[model samples]
Target: MSILSLENVKYSFENTNILNGIDLKISKGDCVSIIGTSGSGKSTLLKLCSDLISPTSGSISFYEKDYNSYEPINLRKQISYCVQIPYLFGDTVYQNLSYPFKIRKQEVNKDKIIKFMKKLNLDESYLEKGINSLSGGEKQRVALIRNLLYKPEILLLDEVTSGLDSQNAKIVQDLIKDLNEDGVTVMWITHSLEQSESIFNKRIQIEQGKIVKEEILK
Candidate 1:
């Protein structure tokens, strides 16, 4: 089943075009890896799909309906984006985890939160710890957990491990792999060739605002 489809999608900033005449389809539960050099428009495509930015031309549809048909807030809940840098707003981990819940007007599921932290090898005590006090890896994991806890139908990852140390990068990498295996549809913008070949079944290569090549890994 196709969950996302972009038809003749184009985006531009000022007079510079970022994406042009792009057409693609992402299936349900697909793990897609988007690869390209910096400024090749890979991230722009992800943002377009996530509705962070709209296309200058063409259309995007989700779940067989126009993406614009869904409310922005609710659409984000179903299709969440995790940028390269971790953005944690709260003073404490507890507050961060509660953010998703608060937005949905629902109570935080403490049991699920604890389980999620444990999966990331985080100590329970860290829940009360300040976000500013957490290490890079810890903050990344918390940011990831917050989005996952939002229960998004699709996940858009934008080079999330690029800024982390080897060990920290592995943690985020493994978490994403695990999530994909567990049936989440993931579109990851990554620079790692090994990761593209190993984790993703489909790969999209972009160049100068166009999808120049596409391959299905065996």
Candidate 2:
């Protein structure tokens, strides 16, 4: 069964349409890349999936259920979102990572968090470091790992590698590929064609808020 589906989804701001008649189906474990130029509504589409905003018209369903039927918080927890620019809280790295767990009443898995940090080339000592002390790349990695630690069914990434250096970007790309291989569905939006081709199994091109082409890379 498809994990997520959008049926003739449309979004508009004022009178200008941002997304028009977008129909998509993402099955479990599918690594789909959304490629388009700036202002093409790629990020908006991701936001809509996460319930950050509602579409102006049309319907979205998740796991064969209408999106509106689920509680907003529950819906968001099942579909994690990582933005282009990382948003770190005014707290320590450990606190930031553990916040989600606290809200969900899940126990903090310190060992697992440390292991994930090490896998991403982040030092264990960073757990106590203030969020503002880290560089842009560091923040992005931390944010990415935080979402991954929860093992959401679907990850919605919007230009997640954009702010990182080439090495860090490659690390993130590889991680996404690994996640997809592990049966996690990924809907990734990126402006980098090269990265899109390398990391995604399927490519969906969007132009002016509409899907222009859908290609299977592998």
Candidate 3:
């Protein structure tokens, strides 16, 4: 089934086009990657998909429903975006991890958090530490776990592994691969051509604000 669809979508800023007549259809549980050079509107396309930015023309739909019809908070719960530079709001990791539950007025899932922490190579003791003490890679992993606790059907990632050391990068890469294998849809943006080639089942290449090609790997 089609989980998300963009039809003739276009976006512009100050008369400069970012995306033009872009059409994409994402199937449930399908892994997709978006690739293009910098300034090619790859990030812009993700923002549009996540409803962070509205298009100048055309439409985006989720599950055959118009994007604008759903409430923003409710929609975001199903489509999560994890950025490269993760933002840690509170002072401590526990506070950050509990944020989702706090906002939802629900109980925190400590068991699930611990389980995911292990899978992401984080120790339970780290959760008690302040965010200021964490390294860059640690912050990124925490951010991912925090967002993923809700189990969003579609996970949007932007250069998720860039700039990290081999170990941290490998931990993230393996974790995400397992998530997709377990049936969470993933769409990511990456600069490494080799990473893009190796990870994605289908790659969409954009150039000059247009989808130039779609490549499916073996």
Model 2, 151-187: lDDT tens digits are: 8899999888777889888888888888889888999
Model 3 residue runs over 4 Å out of place are none
TM-score of each: 0.93, 0.96, 0.95
Q: What is the lDDT of residue 54 in candidate 3?
A: 95
Clashes in model 1: which pairs? Answer: none
Candidate achieving higher lDDT, 1 or 3: 3
Cα lDDT computed for each candidate against the true fold: 0.87, 0.90, 0.89
**Regions of model 1 farther than 4 Å from truth:** none
lDDT of 1: 0.87
**In lDDT terms, which candidate is top?**
2
Tell me the tens digit of each residue's lDDT in model 1 across 136-207: 778878888888985678999898777678776777778778888887899998899987887788999999
Clashes in each model (backbone N, CA, C under 3 Å)? 0, 0, 0
TM-score of 2: 0.96
Shift of residue 91 alpha carbon in model 3, Å: 0.6
Could you tell me how far off, in angstroms, the CA of residue 173 lies in candidate 3 after the best superposition? 1.7
